[model samples]
Each structure stands twice: as C-alpha cells, then as structure tokens.
Target: MPLMHQLWLLVPWAVFALAAGVKFWRLTRPFRRQLAEPSTEQVRASLERRWRADQRELTE
Candidate 1:
C-alpha cells in the first residue's frame, strides 16, 4: 500500500481510540474525584449511620 493510503487508514483508528479514552475518563470521573478527596472518616460515619437505621428498623 502507498504511504498516503496507510496514513488515511490510521486516521480512523486514531479517532476511535481517542473517543474510547475520553468515554472511559468520563465514566471514571466520579471515582477519581472521590479518591482525590480521601474522606474515609465521613464514609465510615455514613455507613455506620445507615447500619444503625437498618438495625432500628429491624428491631421495630
């Protein structure tokens, strides 16, 4: 194949790869934000609160 034809064929693949990468980044954005904050105590407290609520419901 000629060099020009090869370059044209690669352009579509490059665009597809870039689009997939962007989609993946968007999907994981929420997880990335949460990891950036490092709020372990708050998460533990929230889980504890939910557990207490569930226990109360079960007892009642």
Candidate 2:
C-alpha cells in the first residue's frame, strides 16, 4: 500500500482516540476536582469523629 493510504487509515484511529480521551476526561471530572480541592473543615471533623470511635473500639 502507498504511504498516503496508510496515513489515511490512521485518521480514523486518531479521531477515535481523541474522542475517547475527551469522554474519559469528562466522566472523571468530578473525581479530579475532589482530588484537586483541599478537604473541607466539616469533612475533617467527620473523619476525626470516626477515628475516635475506632480508637475507643480498639481500646475495648
């Protein structure tokens, strides 16, 4: 096959890859935001409460 034909074959694959990448980024956007943002004070307090409860259980 000619080089031009080979290059043409790659076009669809490239488009599909770009589309899939965009879809994946959109789907994971919320998770990415959570990772990027700092934990809020309320979340920190809730985690501390849970840790204290677990510690009490461990001591008993």
Question: Which candidate number has the best TM-score?
Answer: 2
Backbone clashes per model, in order?
0, 0
Q: lDDT of candidate 1 vs native?
A: 0.94
| Candidate 2 lDDT tens digits, 1-51 | 999999999999999999999999999999998788576886899899999
Which clashing pairs does model 2 show? none
Each prediction's TM-score versus the true structure: 0.60, 0.65
Alpha-carbon lDDT of model 2? 0.93
Off by over 4 Å in 1: 39-60
50 Cα displacement, candidate 2 (Å)? 4.2
Model 1 residue pairs with clashes = none
